[model samples]
Target: MKKRVLDVGNCGPDHSSIKRFLAKHFDCEVLQADGADDALAALRGGHIDLVLVNRKLDMDYSDGVEVIRQIKAAADVAHAPTMLITNYDEHHEAAMKIGALRGFGKLDLAKPATVEQLQPILGSAD
Candidate 1:
């Protein structure tokens, strides 16, 4: 089965970029969610190997970390690994403090380090 990645709260361009990058380099499916509700529904609906939540939701300008917190609070979906997508170190640290794994920024989507970080979760395209 292909790995599944749930991407939450990114804007159109960033979502496209992320989908493109993941499609090019990993044999996984990328699912989209616009907010915490949508994300939680998607998480409970199926198996998601990893979750990448934008630092700030474009849909309503809400805190993405709060979404992560909600996911962590839910017992059924909390087992899924999550990451915060942001360029700021402070934001990354903040997310990590709340049970998120290391995440990559939109700016670093194609970087070597980002690829390395994703490899373990999504593996490589076959």
Candidate 2:
């Protein structure tokens, strides 16, 4: 079965880009959640291999760190790995402190390193 990735809080364009990237490189399905509540609901409803949250939610401008905290705190979905999408070191560090794995910046989406980072979580396309 294909792995499922729940992408939270990214804008329309970013979501599209991430969906395409994951589909092409990881062979995974990308699910969308515009906010924490939707994200949590999706997690509870099904199995998600990974959760990717933007640094700042475009819909509400909420901190993605708080969303990551909630996911980690939730008993049902805590097992799923999480990654914060951001270019800022401080923000990435903050997400890691809250139990998120190392994630890549949008600017680095096409980088080989990004593919390497995701391979462990999502596996190779082939």
Candidate 3:
């Protein structure tokens, strides 16, 4: 069966790029969530295996860190790997503290190097 991934980000160019990249590399289904609430709902619904959360989401309800915390607190997805994607360096430490598996700067993700960096993580998750 194909692996499943929840990609929480604004529906835009950046999110499209990341979703396309993952779809190309693995037999996976990508589900888009506009913000923290939607992401948490998706996780609780067992629709995804991992979560790729954008640092900035559409809603003002909460940020990615809080989303990660919610996921970690939930029994269903507590062990799910949460990866935070951002353009800022300052959020990295905070994301890790909230239970994110890793942080990928959008700058790095824009480069071809992103594939190399993501390979091992995706492979293991699969």
Candidate 4:
């Protein structure tokens, strides 16, 4: 069966770009959520194998770190791998501290050399 992925992002451009990339390479089902509640609901529904969460959401709510924590705290989904994406360089350390399986800043996503850096983490989620 194809692996499922939950992609939580408030920005349409970034969410669309990542969804396009993943869809091209993997049999990924993308679930776009605007906030923590939607993301959690998706996870509870049982189709998600991995998650790629944006570091910030609408109205400055639901950062990636909190999403990661919620996933880890959930008994059913704790084992799922989470990749946190952010535009802020400083949040890199914070993301790592929160137990994200992988963390990539927007600068890395902008460059082709590092854009595919998420492949390994996504692959491992399978």
Q: Which candidate wins on TM-score?
A: 2
Candidate numbers, best TM-score first, in rank order? 2, 1, 3, 4
TM-score of 3: 0.81
Write out the backbone clash pairs for model 1.
none
- Pairs of colliding residues, candidate 4: none
Worst 10 residues of 1 by lDDT: 117-126
Superposed by TM-score, candidate 3 places the C-alpha of residue 61 at a distance from the truth, in angstroms, of: 7.9
Model 1, 17-41: lDDT tens digits are: 9999998888889999999999999
* Per-model RMSD to reference: 1.0, 0.9, 2.8, 3.2
**What is the alpha-carbon RMSD of candidate 2 to the true structure?**
0.9
Candidate 4 per-residue lDDT, tens place, 26-46, comes to 677777887667778888878
**Model 3 regions lying over 4 Å from their true place:** 110-112, 124-126
Q: Residue-wise lDDT of candidate 2 within 16-58, one digit each (tens)?
A: 9999888878778899999899999999999899999999999
Number of backbone clashes in candidate 4: 0
For each candidate, give its TM-score against the true structure: 0.96, 0.97, 0.81, 0.77
State the lDDT of candidate 3 residue by residue for 69-88, as single tens digits. 77788877778888888767
The order by descending lDDT is 2, 1, 3, 4
lDDT of 3: 0.74
Candidate 1 regions off by >4 Å?
A: none
